[model samples]
Target: MREAFDHMYISCWEWSISVLEEVGATKPLYPPTMLRFTKRDTNSATPGPYSYPAMTLDECQLADFSEFETFDNYCYAMFTFYQLIQQTSGLSGEVNLEVRSPRFLETVASKDDIFLIEGMHCVKFKNDRFEEKVMAHWRREMPVRTFRRKDRA
Candidate 1:
């Protein structure tokens, strides 16, 4: 299951990078990022000692993640990250009002996971002009999984 989750997570990240590239906004958008792969045995009977290695993406190869998968999970991840960037940079109002190709609608229907589903809803609001009724519906819906960072300290 660890490997499957890792594959899913990495695939999601790759999808994000690909969408960013399609928009011709990779350099200005993707910050230096890292992925730390970890595995722990949930069964108490088996482990004597175990430590998982954290891997950092080399500067030159960070863009390679863009090829992880062809699924819509990538586009949703990009939208989520873009929102994060806007919030962090305090430039939410400065984002372009124009919608671009590979629009959220094009990719949303293909998503299989709840995280990506909620992500699509959020992206819809962020990218297009929606009715107040529609916006309220999505806002009321809860996401399946909230992103969390492992405690490293």
Candidate 2:
């Protein structure tokens, strides 16, 4: 990280609270927090993208966000993740894309969002598996076995 910063310019400016204050940004945009996990959404009537991506953090982390320059920026960061869940969703009748590891999270948000944004080492998006009964229902013409979520245990 330092190498890249040093390479860009002769004078390597350090990012600090004072610098942020000078620019009217008192704190980091997104504080370190945990990515809220999702459970099965049973409501069929609801929209297609059932889950909303949220960040969960302990009291310490929440306090960190208090240093944010603007609440709008903070909230925007949250909504952006939810947007990604929608964008990366699988094809029709398919499952949502998985956030398997730290690397994949970078696609939607910045690297800082991975560590500071989600405060998690690994973020994964799980696909639902289709059950045998579901397949049998479509006896005339069944889609691929991986078309749906796995059976609920």
* Every candidate's lDDT: 0.33, 0.29
Angstrom error of the Cα, residue 100, model 2: value is 3.8
Q: What is candidate 1's local distance difference test score?
A: 0.33
Local accuracy of candidate 1 as per-residue lDDT tens digits, 12-124:
34444434433333322111232133343346322212112122223423434444343233334544554544453354333222333234434442352322222332322
Residue 27, candidate 1: alpha-carbon lDDT: 26
Writing each residue's lDDT as its tens digit, candidate 2 over 58-103 gives 3223444334434233233333333344345444322222433334
* RMSD in order of candidates: 14.4, 20.3
Clashes of each: 1, 8
Q: What is candidate 1's TM-score against the reference?
A: 0.25
Angstrom error of the Cα, residue 21, model 2: value is 16
